[model samples]
Target: MGFAVAIVMCALLIASTTESQHNEAILRARIVTLTAENQRNGVALHARLAACEGGPADLARSRAASALLTPEQRAQHLAANGPQGFDVCARMESADRAVLETLK
Candidate 1:
């Protein structure tokens, strides 16, 4: 009887651990999705704001802000929206890299 109870307890522990891990993975995936969605929304909002201003200065400001994104992010943005969309990000990367080199 004791051995049977021990086996049952062990099985329950394993099942609970598996469930916890699954839950954690689901939450992690959700966080990643939400973060990406928010980043995309911010980028879109910047473009909209620039359009609303209807001037070169606003467009330039929007381009400068795009440079703040990481290279990977720039690549992803370009891939999704095409080369024209990320022109400013790509253009600024070299200058940013040069400054970083000077700082180093």
Candidate 2:
């Protein structure tokens, strides 16, 4: 009876150790997955930030094209749009900067 009890206890101990190791492996895999996902997200965020930084330059070029227009045409365009695109780009840049700040 004593030998049988010792055998059973050893078996239980081995089973517990195996289970713990399995759980640790699973946790490690999850960590790896999360890290990769984080890297991808970071890359995407940087791309968006670059785009946001470029927005003003693109807008300036677009406005420069309007420089070729007659005064009346420029006035009509300004009156109709009133720098709305500039406002939108400014807002987007501000928001992206805010997100970056929080990450830091």
Error of 2 at 97 (Å): 13
RMSD of each: 10.6, 12.4
TM-score of 2: 0.52
Per-residue C-alpha lDDT of model 1 across residues 1-104, encoded as one tens digit per residue: 99999999999999999999999999999999989987996687455333332246455763676668764554555556543424555455566568769978
Off by over 4 Å in 1: 54-104
TM-score versus the correct structure, for each prediction: 0.48, 0.52
lDDT of 2 by residue, 1-104 (tens): 99999999999999999999999999999999989988997787544433333245467764566658754455455446545454554576578779879989
Alpha-carbon shift of residue 80 in model 2 (angstroms): 26
Worst 10 residues of 2 by lDDT: 46-55
**Predicted model with the maximum lDDT:** 2
Candidate 2 clashes between residue pairs 3 or more apart in a chain or in different chains:
none
